[model samples]
Target: MEKFSFDGPPVGDDADISAECQRQLLSPIQEIVKAAVAAGWSRQDVLLAMVELSWDMYEKRRGDL
Candidate 1:
């Protein structure tokens, strides 16, 4: 079986950008959510994705210690 890996967003050594850059990034996220809803992603799907992402983060942090 193939293993899955996730690379989380940069947390260290990344300088904070300007507010405009943040604003620009928000649009793509909004578009994807709009697309997801259009493609019939249910409330449960969203919730499950959130849970999985949180679990992955927890496991990675635990393993890093």
Candidate 2:
């Protein structure tokens, strides 16, 4: 399929919640990794999360290319 990119608002111009909230929202994802290590989550679970994160990042910056 063909893809197109949209021009986005300037960074940091978001009216959304503050950066602190963003950090808080994501901190748990890190904790989840450590806890999962102790709890013995399968390697597949950890790797799947990584793949999802990578794809999300690629989409986020697709406009730059």
Give residue 53's lDDT in candidate 1 (0 to 100): 89
Q: Once all C-alphas are superposed, what RMSD does model 2 give against the true structure?
A: 9.9
Question: Please, what is the TM-score per model?
Answer: 0.38, 0.39
lDDT of 1 by residue, 1-59 (tens): 33434334445556455444555556655665567778999756765786698699999
- How do the residues 1-65 of candidate 2 rate in per-residue lDDT, one tens digit apiece? 33433334335656455455545546555666777878988757986987799799999999999
Candidate 2 wrong stretches, greater than 4 Å: 1-36
The number of the candidate with the highest TM-score is 2
lDDT of each candidate versus the true structure: 0.64, 0.67
Candidate 2: residue 50 lDDT (0-100):
73
